[model samples]
Target chain A: MDILDLAFMQRALLAALLVGVTAPAIGTYLVQRRQALMGDGLGHVALTGVGLGFLLNESPVWMATAVCIAGAVVMELIRWYGRTRGDIALAMLFYGGMAGGVMLMNLSDSGSSANLSSYLFGSIATVSEEDLVAICILAAFVILTTVGLRRQLFAICQDEEFARVTGLPVRMLNLLVAVTAAVTVTVAMRVVGLLLVSALMVIPVAASQQIARSFKATFALAVGIGVTVTVSGTATSYYADVPSGATIVLFAIGLFVVLTALATPLAKRRAGRTAAAEECTLEAPGERTAADDVRV
Target chain B: MEQPVIALRGGVASLGGRPVLRGVDLAVRPGEVVALLGANGSGKSTAVRSIVGQVPLTGGELELFGTPQRRFRDWARVGYVPQRTTAAGGVPATVREVVSSGRLARTRFGMMRRADKEAVIRALELVGMADRLGDPVDALSGGQHQRVLIARALAGEPELLIMDEPMAGVDLASQEVLAEALRAQVARGATVLLVLHELGPLEPLIDRAVVLRDGCVVHDGPPPEAVGQHALPGHDHVHPHAGPAAEPIRTGLLT
Candidate 1:
């Protein structure tokens, strides 16, 4: 039977596709808000939850999801109250989470350490039927919430003070973003693993922003890039005997590098053209200067 | 007597445990262009922010259009232009998209109606940014960015327009365009409250000036004549000879 016909391979691919779509969908906002590392912070917290599960002999995925949501709320509160020094609080949480996870994992049995390692690097062959169902349900919730509040989220991200002045419930919308980010990170952990899930959430969005002109276009293109990278990376890892999470993240970084290299010259050329057109229309024919043609 | 469109009586507010506004009283009648003048840290921005409910008052009363601020729900009736900063943040939105977002309070389910789109276009035209509606805002100059923000506010068709330092970093040409735009809005009977440093081109349109010094109202009448004479050296020091009560007014001129 071909690899596609194998049940484990089929499940892994489905999970990859689902995460590939949702991670960057939520990530577009995170990247725009300059909070790209929020996903990584939540992912670290999820690892702590997984460690707790190992200690208690429970389903690690469910525990991780719950802990991540709670951690996200805490982070949001810190961001609100800490004001200018909010990044310090986030950094504390980021390091605390990783340290806590390692300590908790050490306290658990040695056999479970192997399981934790799989979650760290991700083993596509190990995604069970139950994990697939959980991911689908959570992914659906994330997508729905994000779609319902897209405009409000965009407004808050653009300018929080202005959004508040407009009576957009800026505080509530900010909390919603944090919760959605947490959910996305939790669901993505299955595919890219806790340590590398942030790559799936941020890289494609960064790549798309370089080329896309508007917010909507950037979001659409990021999703496209995300799905392509996840699907191809999964297949490559399967055939090449590589760690799936690392392979997928590396693939995304490579694509980002390529897009960045191509975007600069194209953007400069387009800007020059627009500048020339503007000068031609706004200035008198006799008064037009050659200096106006030079791109700032 | 007709009630003022914006009334902040005994307005006291604090930020991070530091008192910013102390028993400040301001009232703007309908159709009047009022300028809030003060130097940096004079609490002019904080006072307006309190009116918009962004800054919580430690002890005071703010009323918008005859309704208590706590009970006011008519957000579409108010337009706001915050002080300009580097517009680099979040997603790169097109000029049209940014302006369209201004109408959100008036739209249901965040869906823009045809009328909403028309208003956005009209607002852009008002600011002379109609030709660049599809351009990303980040690519625009500081002055162009300010105009886009003003257009965003105007798109909402607010009865009351509150702008904080709208001309702070704008170029002279853009300032003229903004002044003309304000003239049109005033002619249309929109109530405007502007926080300004020197008034500049907008000086002619201002009917009343409320100058603040260390969070207290020092002058509340015609625009200070000293401001128009800014070209003279030591203009700020040439204050009207008066008693101790006039000290705050002299300090306000230092702005």
Candidate 2:
């Protein structure tokens, strides 16, 4: 309660809430599209953007957003042209981004690495007013694009080839997803850092899929789970000494494990009941008599 | 004669430097049900894919509803059902929601009007899965899942329906259900092109069959009666001989 009164803590909490909602909202599509690792890939690319910002004395969040967007476009192009799996291109970008960021950070003045460390591990203590503003703007953009494209996104995620055959602009929609994901990773980097940002994107959705029966329900539930983890994890981190990013991601993983453990058996039981009901209906006298008559 | 609903001539496509469709020609007239039959890797899927612009033709001419393939933007006139795979990409979408997506081309800016909803419900009814509208697609049996996919295509009310292996992996009961659904569509004057490994329940509805061998059209004529039996699993060696061995049939007798 005391932490909520502090200005920095308030900003940190707000940032957590925003990222929490936007991350999983975007993650729902990525997870459904089987591109869960794309968040991690963009996060790594964001680090280089952060390093570029440090070297140029610009806003790191904006710089990171720009770099990540470019990285995302390049990654998509690779997927479009490359013969191998899209993950191969993502793996290349993932390592390349981290390595590029570290080298760029090393190339900067001696004191900059300490500043970059805040981004690497995430420090609620460092969320500035400008960073908060950036998160709000980018988060709004991500949310709007995702909501507006919900139908098309769902169609493509269900089956890309089928979506194409139906004449949806599959390629443009895919690029939109990539760019939105890039922005989400950049905005979330301040709350959960580059290393753990993807967990915020993927973990909640993974948990939601275990129980939610509809896409809308799964998306809403994932957002709820994400928000809960980010807010509670931020609060716990403030009271304890651990980094907020790691704490949030760890909390998410714990939630996923618990939800999966609980939902699997319940789902199996429901399936068993449905099967039994179907068998009973099939053996009803009217149907059995018709079958017997046909045989005779 | 009215122009064919779908026309692909000299279609040549290569994937990963390997030719998948080599000089393939296929044409389906309005209200006709033509099946594309082939062995695995014989390019049956690719031919259908090419018509819908999924596969780029290296050297070919394609037309849909009399418009050049390059200029064919009237998606509402066409419906496509891809082969059913085991995974629905892990997206937890209810049957109604999945079927509603087929109406995307008809909806402006992706906004579903009242008519779209009615069409979706009607499609579900046609597939005999109306009761399972709220259930997740993942919960359905393979047959039921296939039926839901067919309903998705039907919701569009497309004049030309192209399906790739709709019967593959489906049980007989579901196949019969799908056959009845297709029959209804054909009755309403819908033209159909299908890729099938064998003509089972769909055989009765098929007006003609085009068989592909190694990416080339080997036979295009009345549905091979012998293929109905040869198409059975474990009966791979029974090849149908329709004409002189020296010449490939370029046109179907039914046409």
Best by lDDT: 2
- Show where candidate 1 strays beyond 4 Å: A84-88, A106-111, A275-296, B85-90, B227-255
Model 1 agreement with the true structure over B23-138: per-residue lDDT tens digits: 99999999999999987899999998889888899897889999999999888899998874323355567888777878787788788889999999999999899999998887
TM-score of chain B of 1: 0.88
Whole-structure CA lDDT of model 1: 0.83
State the lDDT at B17 in candidate 2. 90
Q: Give the worst 10-residue stretch by lDDT in candidate 2 chain A.
A: A287-296
Model 2 segments more than 4 A misplaced: A85-89, A275-296, B85-88, B227-255
Error of 1 at A30 (Å): 1.4
lDDT by residue for model 1 (A78-197), tens: 987998888888888888887787788889884266777788877776888988888898889888876777777777777776777777887888888888888887788878898888
Query: Which 10 residues in a row give candidate 1 chain B its minimum summed lDDT?
Result: B246-255
Mark the 10 consecutive residues where model 1 chain A has the least summed lDDT: A287-296
